[model samples]
Target: MTTILVTGGTGTLGRLVTERLREGGHEVRVLSRKAEPYAVDLREGGPALDRAVEGVEAVVHCASTPRGGDERAARNLIGAARRAGVPHLVYISIVGVDRVPLGYYKAKHAVERLVEGSGLGWTVLRATQFHELVQQMLSTFARSPVMVLPAGVADQPIEVAEVADRLAGLAVRPPAGRVPDMGGPEVRTFPDLARAYLRATGRRRAVVSVPLAGKTYRAFRSGGHLAPEQAVGKGTFEEYLRR
Candidate 1:
């Protein structure tokens, strides 16, 4: 059985990946700052993270920071992987990171480039936003009586477990650089998602579409973050709300 180390293993998607890998009879290690019991954190490339990399056959990089320091973390992880001679490095990136103007997107794009140039056999899978995260965003707006959403943004929120399954597939196979982007089965406008959330919760709230300015919104409205043709996920936003 191959030993696999999953960064951000305690997070939504990473947790699924780790569990799936273990079910497949592959040895798995979880890496996260809050890691406990069956996991360990990188500690910014300290001994624990370094030792975790040692002897692992592959690494699924699902770890990310909310405040946008993914590039630094990616660099440190790449160094450790190289030193450990880890054969395959599988990274989960966003669908429109290269085109999106957001700061976090820029950092993720940089990490993609670093992995490509790191000289290790690597596979990069760019996926649309997870349903859980999208739900969380909408929940934030649903806090008040009036929900405000971006005027023209659209999203294809895929299932986190589906993405994890695909990542697990990549971990076992030979590295294929930049696979086809993964997306949800359906596309929903921002307002539509907000409305769905309200409907699901049996709440009556006036939904307001606020036109957001700047390059970030422009890219989002332009559909940079969608992979309509891919639609690789089995779950839909409606189904997600039901659960």
Candidate 2:
């Protein structure tokens, strides 16, 4: 069995990916800040990082700090991977990262470039938003009885497990640069999502759609984050709500 190190292994997608790798008969080493077997924080570069990357056949780079420091974290991972001569580096990125004007998206786009040009074998899988993330977003904003949503933006929120499974598949295969993007089974608007949430929880909330401007809104309206032609996920937003 090959040994693989998974960054952000305790996080949502990271946990799922790590479990899948272990189930597939690979020795999975989880990277976290805690005192785990492979505890390494990407932001704090030190000798610990080199040891974390050493001897691992591949790295599933699920770690991120969108709140801040994502670019630096990614750079550290790439540098460590390069120094250790790891064969494959699998990155989980967002769809429309390059097209979107959000700061987090821009940081992710920079990370993508770092991985591609790191001179190491790498694969980047750009996926639409996860159902959990979208649900949380709408639910948090729905508190005041009125759910405000951006008008005309279509989102294909996929299951996190589906993306995790895809990452697991990529972990075992040869690196394929920027593989086919993945999305959910359905394309939906932000208000539609809020409405679904309201119905599912038996909650009463009015959804107010707001028309937004700028390059970000335009990109979202254009469905730059959607991969309808490649929607491999079988789970739907309604089904997710039921669970």
Candidate 3:
């Protein structure tokens, strides 16, 4: 079994990937700030990274920061992987990162460029927004009797589990350089999603569609964040709510 190093193994997607790797009988080393099997911080460059990555065959780079720090974090991790002579580097990025002009997306796009130009065997999987994120959005907007949603657009969201599975599969295989984009099974509008969520939760509420103005709003309206043709996830909003 090959030894694989997983950065951000404590996170949602990272934890899932680590579990899958371990289940497949591979030696899985997790890099986190807190004490664990292997602990390393990307921001703090030192021997810690060298120790964490020692003897590892591949690196699954799932660690990332907020919009501002994402690019820097990616660069640091790439450098470390090169130094460790890791054969493959798998990066998880969001769909529409290039089409959208958001700060976080800008950082993601920058990181993709770094990985592509690193001359390393690398694969980037661009996935749609997670189901959990949609749930959170619903919960946040549905605080009052009226759930306010952006009137202009919709999204095709995927489950974290599906994305995690894809990431794990990519980690085990050789790099394929920018895999196909993955998305949810259904195309849903924000208000429709909110309504469904309220129904599933047995909460009585009215979803109010509010037209928003700005580049962010226009991006959403233009379907910048979805991949309807590439919806590969089997989970739907109803199924997610049931779970």
Candidate 4:
């Protein structure tokens, strides 16, 4: 069986991918800042990073920071992979990163470019926003009996578990370049999602739509961050809330 290394193995998506790879009878190693199976910081490339990738057939890079520093991290990981002679490199990116003008989106686009230019067998999967993130937004933005959201928007959010499954599948196969975009089963407005969340939690709240300004508003209103036809996830927001 191939030895696969997963970066950011402690995070939401990375943990699921690690478990799936291990269950498949592969030697799964995790790279984290703390001492674990291995310790490697993608942001700082050095002996630790090299050691993590050594003798591994594939590298699933899930380690990413906020938009500003992600490109540098991607570059360092690519260099480490080249040094370790890892055959396959799989990257997980967000859907519509290129279409959105957010700082995080810009960083993700840069990472994709780095992987493409690295001259290695690489696959990139662009997935929609995770259900957990949406839930967090609901919790943070909800005020007592009302939830405020940007006016005029639609989102097809995917479950993190589903995205992890797809990432694990990509890790086993040879690099396929860019895979088909993955998204959730249903399209819901921001306010609707908030209302559903409140109802699921047995709380009564009014969904309020607040018009926003600037690039973030434009991006959300224009539906630049959604993947309508490409949605492949089975879980709905309600299902996620129920769980």
> Tens digit of lDDT per residue, candidate 4, span 1-243?
989999889999999999999989989899877846587667777887888888999999998877366787788888888988889999999988998898888889989999988988999999999999898888887755667778898889898999998999999999999989998998898877887888898777778787889987798789888988887899999999988
Could you tell which candidate, 1 or 2, scores higher by lDDT? 2
Which digits, one per residue and each the tens of the lDDT, describe model 1 over residues 23-108? 99999988888786335444356667678899999999999876866877888899989999999999999999989889888888
Better of 2 and 4 by lDDT: 2
TM-score of 2: 0.97
Residues 1-243, candidate 2: write the lDDT tens digits: 989989999999999999999999999889988737777778986789999999999999998877988788888888888899999999999988988888899999999999999899999999999999999998898888687888888789999999999999999999999999998999988888888989999999888888988988888898888889988889999999999
Any runs in candidate 3 off by more than 4 Å, and if so which? none
After TM-score superposition, the amount by which residue 32's alpha carbon in candidate 1 deviates from its true location, in angstroms, is 1.1
TM-score of each: 0.96, 0.97, 0.96, 0.96
Ranking of all predicted structures according to lDDT, beginning with the best and ending with the worst: 2, 1, 4, 3
Residues 21-119, candidate 3: write the lDDT tens digits: 998899988898774656766777577887887678888888887636667666777787888888898989989999888888888889899999987
Residue 210's lDDT in candidate 1: 88
**Worst window of 10 by summed lDDT in candidate 2:** 32-41
> Which portions of model 2 miss their true places by more than 4 Å?
none
Clashing residue pairs, candidate 2?
none
Give the whole-model CA lDDT for all candidates, comma-separated: 0.89, 0.90, 0.86, 0.87
Model 4 quality (TM-score): 0.96
Each candidate structure's count of clashing pairs: 0, 0, 0, 0
